[model samples]
Target: MDFRAINTIVFAFLITMCSFGQINCNCSIGSYLEKIELLNTRDSLEVFELSAELKKTKLEVCKFKALEIEFNYFITQLNEEKAFAVLNELEDYLGRINCESDLKFNIYINKAKYFKLHNNYEKLSEFAFKALKEAEYLKDSNKEIEAIKQIVYLFTRMDEDDKNWQYIKRAEKLIFKQSNPIRSVKNFRWLAFEYETKYTRTKRKPLLDSLFIFANHSKKGAKKYNIFDELALSYRALEAYSYHKGNAKNALKYIDSAIFYAKKIKGKKNLSGLYISKAWDHLDWGEKELAVKWMDTSFAYDTKDDIAGFMMHHLDATDLYEQAGRLDKALSSYQIHSRIKDSIFNTERTQVINELETKYKTELKDAKIKRLNVLLVITLLIIVSILLAGSVIQLKRTRKKNKILKRAIEEQERLEKELSDVRGEIAQDFHDDLGNKLARISLLSSLISGEVSIKSPNIKSKIKQINEDANGLYKGTRDFIFSLKSNSDYLEEVVTYLSDFGGDIFNKTEIKFTVEKHISTNVKLPYYWSKQIVFIFKEALTNAMKHSNCHTVKLSFGYQGYQLSIRCEDDGIGILESDLQSLNGLSHMKTRGIKIGCELLINSNIGEGTAVILKGNLKEDII
Candidate 1:
């Protein structure tokens, strides 16, 4: 069959397996592939339906296997572009899908096959090594054997015999640990091809014997596994070996066997190679016409888009044509072969240039992106710096304003303290100097009154009254000094001073003065409030001592909640209610309490004593 018909069959078989394999019968992948291989190839419409149905399956493993099969189908069809596109899809899915080691092994093996078809030996070697590692990780001896075989094939193609033999031995070690007939057949065939090539180059008999032995070993496994492709390859290796030995009869026999088996498979990819071997046989046998015919047939079968294969076909044609004395055809074939060689060389050069251009463009784009990132960072930093600077400047201005206000408050406090000190000093001087002078004047008047009482009775009486006035003046001046000298900010100080003043005033009198204090020491009284309280107490005391004829006087200071109270009462001859207006001292006390925000009350009866009560809200006074 032709290449197109073979590819269509392979493509159809893959699609059928991918779509109906597990869906219709719940069959395993191996069973599905076997079933499809037995059926006739389907058409393109069936292939499309299969692809659509495969996409509908929810299983990631199924989708992944379908993609792999599609990739292989394209490879068999000699569709490198579509195969590479499928490979890209596989790689992209690999990152997204979490697959098992067996799946990874298959993915790498497929990639290796892709590079092998494209003749990219380096990449082929790379993926082969990767697949080998995945196989080892999976502990699948069969996959490992296949990967090692691919490595062997690549090394042999590159003419590195040492590397090729090293991998062959590695595959051999793995093959003994496993039982995969197909893989064993593949390994043996590779070994046979290796020995046959070596024998042809060195013309060694020992190498020829080794080649025949490996070829026969491969044939044994191929027949057991029904692997016709490897079997055909083994026959080709034997044909080359026999041809090198100058055994034309044996070589022709082997070539016919290679062709017979190769014809069983479609596309005739191996058949083309076998035809070349037959043409070589005809040349050796000196049948120039038959040689040309075989060469033409080989060229017709070389349908794959491989520049190296076409070049080899033309080169062989040129030699055959020259030997046949077809000078025109010989020169034409040589020229075509040379042109194809140049095209291959130029194609490689263009690829290199494209890679360099792509690399340069990528680097330039990266540099621009880096530069833009730096600019963005710098802009952000500059904006942040400006904001910080503005904050610092505003903070400094606020601190400066606070400093100015603090200094103003301190200076005001200093001046008020100085004024208070000056007032206290003046009060002290008034009490010490003026109060003492008035006391001395009163003593002198009393002495004069006593000395002239009998000789000048009128003069003694007037002098006695003057002495009483001077005494009253001294007491008033002392009271004034006491009130003025101390601040009333401390409730304890004010109450204590008032109690002391009452004690001193009635010390020589018959009236007993009792000071009852129940106020907390922490209570604060305003200055004006304290002075008015002291004045009211003094007035009540003086009125009692001079006119009430009381035996005891009680003075009390108390506080509850935020209210302060001062009380003074005496058990004396109580004044009449009509006489209250006549008392100027009582009136003055009332006026002072009003000015200091205190409530003043006077209670008196004809037989009971008089009581003066003062109540003040200390909190109201402070406010």
Candidate 2:
């Protein structure tokens, strides 16, 4: 027998032995698959026999895998008839015998590839979606990524850019979830090609950059896996990027590199495609003779079945010939182009026939599956009814609990308001009654001190001490009343109070106080949050007033989107970073921010100044 036959027989023998031997059957199966993949189109008979031998295996999964390998072999050889026949066989196998979801998934992907290769867009779209659904059901991210990529390409070919972008977005999401290096490389290369095509059409700088990025990533992955084909494609992408950037020298440099790599690989198709690309660049730059030279060189490289590339070359030749005033040659080239276009039309018609046959078969299979699905649906409905009854009872309990929770929340809010009112009343009592009384005491003591100074020095000293104590008590009461006041929670009210308080406190001092409000005056906050925020602000201000020996203390407020931001900055000899660890007031400000669900930032330098920022999400906290 021939070498291929001998090789196939040996591999099959090894697999059979391993199946009954002590070695792992899966390892032997993989070896068998490796051998099959190693065979080219010339080894068709051997491939066919080896593929048929898969049915001898006891494992159903292996049978499914064998069918996939057989189908792939036919596809790679461009034997569409055999490929579809094998696909139909696989479908029949699935109908009669039980197979794993993975097997079924592979069958769907194979059918998708068949349709895609034949340019049956409608069938390809349907199969791609089916594959995606299966992949998602199996939680197979790699498979899902492949399906999404195919769908993206299909939509792009259909000129449905919006739909293509949606699939691109989906592929991006799925790619990150897959951790396989080779698969990642493949996905990135697909993305690179997609963007590269778009760049070629639009000549958009951003799209070119995107292509370069993904292409670079693909190169890295390919180098890691020793995949020369992908490496060559990456180089071609770089060439495209450079050419589009108006750098002919650099573009030619990359194309040379790509050609060198492509020569090392088995596929002359890629090599010829590169030559076509180089020719087109020369043609675009008005180098007609150089373009013709490269076109002849491309023809020398056996570009098997590269119809698109052939079309491009023919069209370019026609243009050049017409420009040279060679009417006969130009007419001949145009006629050849017309013939190629007719062939494409014929191919499209064949694909339509294939699509109809596949659809009819699918419908017949679905009719059978639908019967089984109806029984499953009935069983599911019974389970769902039981679940629904339970859900209703549980939902009622949840509703009851929600009602109780709401009532408790309302009651709590009411009590909080009442408590705030009571605190306000007490503050009013302290400010109006106790503060006035203390002031009166201070005045009376001063008068007594003046009257007794002539009679007794001891009485005069005692009256003077009483006056100083009353003055201290009055000041303390005023500060306490200010803290207890509820109006501080309102945005406008707090800002006005801060301005007046700062003006009064710093009036006699050299320091200046500034309050700048960037937010609306009508912006209101929850009572608890506003209270905490104000308390934090007061602490920061107090620290600045007591310690920062500066000219200005500025307070600013801003609201953007859902966030409310407040800043307290002082122009002063700021606190040391090391000293900040021990600052009690700063710690209190941070704690209050945490309690209010805000982010607090404190920035300080020894000589620059200090800034305190408190930011919170108003959308979440306001309610």
Candidate 3:
């Protein structure tokens, strides 16, 4: 076994034990998932480094992610035993976590892929069937269709026409219902590859036509979705079809297009392959010089660090150089290819020998580890029980000691009541004094502006601004009083309070405003909920008057059972699709809704109307 693979598995187990031993980690699972996905996967050392990071997250889900990445790395290196070990670890993790259906389906799919890698058709078919069942149970159409495609690909490889076509039609039925035409791109590519091979062998006209038709279907779907990855592949297939059909111009053109898209995606793997195909097309068209140039370009894209890529590049280079009559270069390429091939074979043999030698020792180690883990869990349970018992004892003792303080508690409650009364009185006095003074300032400014408008035009503008400022100050003073003084904690109070403000404000506007409420009983609400709702309502109403050329606006409040809903709607020239995205106050309203833990949505269409709807659950705390 590779030491890295063994270390990775051991570290993953440590993370599992730590995460389950503690109840919470203060780390967001979603954020950790995003961070894990962004890590470099092209190197084994980076994957090993992820183990230390997983300790920070202390999440079983992170362990699963690490193991999956390690599995893919081993599989890519053709380290079959290590890959199988990782798969077994994954299966164990599934049972340990009592995993979700999606994770279970993922495990089954990985099993199918693993078996396919080993050419175990029987096992592949078994796991594929399991995945299809799991996908159906999960009620995910995309996953179900993917599983069907896997089975279809399996039968395609085995040359089972009946079973292949059976699954294909089933997948197509689901595809039509899904209505995402791009999903068919890979399916069409599979059929095209299958037919193209048969056509190459028999030169049958029907097979040739079917090959081109499926290739074109793939191309159209890929282009429609702007899926550059699949579009590059589809064009490569088209290039092959064109070459076989003896259309030199179209063949070369399609290869160039494939290269263009592969570059767009910065897909080194696909780019290297496409460059090789372009070289072959040129060589077959009797342009040996251009073929040599293209083959050299492919060498630049194929990274030297990738053993498989390096080996394949040299092998192809040998063939191309030999065909171009460059005997010396061809001989050098063949020598390098032979050296790499032998090195890979030797490495595999050595790893296999070491794996067999460690088999018994590994099994013994695993059994001991399992026993240690069981003992650790039992120890943790005992410690937790002890802590909980101590907490209960302390609570009971405190309650007994507090029983003799009843007289003091009663006196404290009396003081609290008096303090609340005094606070109310201070709020009322502050509002009355400042509000009257601001109102007097507004009245004097308005009288002076009326005389100045006829006598001095410039001074009239200044006086009018002073009158508006004074009125604004008065409104601000009243709102500050409301905030400082409100003691109501009921949804009914909020509805009634906002209702009075709406009636007064709309009376001054040409647009009609109406309030409808279905609040039955006084539902308990937190200050934060009521405050944000009031601000959101005011912002929506202001926007409607300024931006929406509306005849009437309606505000509705509703509370029934456990649900609370509010809507601010306007019968105006509704927002255009372009302008709706840039609607001012959208982010502000959304932020407010988020703070109150509510769902907020804006719906509109041209010439119809606009509606801002908010909904949330009334929690059990509302006694």
lDDT value for model 3: 0.74
Q: Give the poorly placed runs of model 2, Cα more than 4 Å off.
A: 1-58, 95-97, 119-122, 136-139, 152-162, 267-270, 284-286, 300-335, 342-623
Estimate, for each residue in 1-623, the C-alpha lDDT of model 3 and write its tens digit. 56566456556666777766664422346555544534434356766677557645567766776787778766655567888999998888767655544388878888886876665555667777778777765677877887887677666554456656667667756655665465577667766766765666568778778778888998898777666767888888888888888886788999999888866652124367788888888988999989889988888777564554576688889999999888887899899988976754454554443353245246546756886786686555556655778899989988887875776788888985786677578768977788888888899988887666476878888888988998988876665565555454567777876777777777888999888988887787755687778778877887888788898999999988889999999999888878767766877898899998899998999988889999999877663
Residue lDDT tens for model 2, 413-492: 99989988998999888888999899999999987777774769888888888899999788767656765777655667
Write one digit per residue (lDDT tens) for candidate 1, span 319-386: 87888767787899899988876754455644553354345346556756886886685555556655
Candidate 2 RMSD to the correct structure? 16.0
The Cα error of candidate 2 at residue 31, in Å, is 9.1
User: Using Cα atoms with residue i matched to residue i, what is each candidate's TM-score against the true structure?
Assistant: 0.44, 0.46, 0.38
Best by TM-score: 2
Candidate 3 clashes: the total is 0
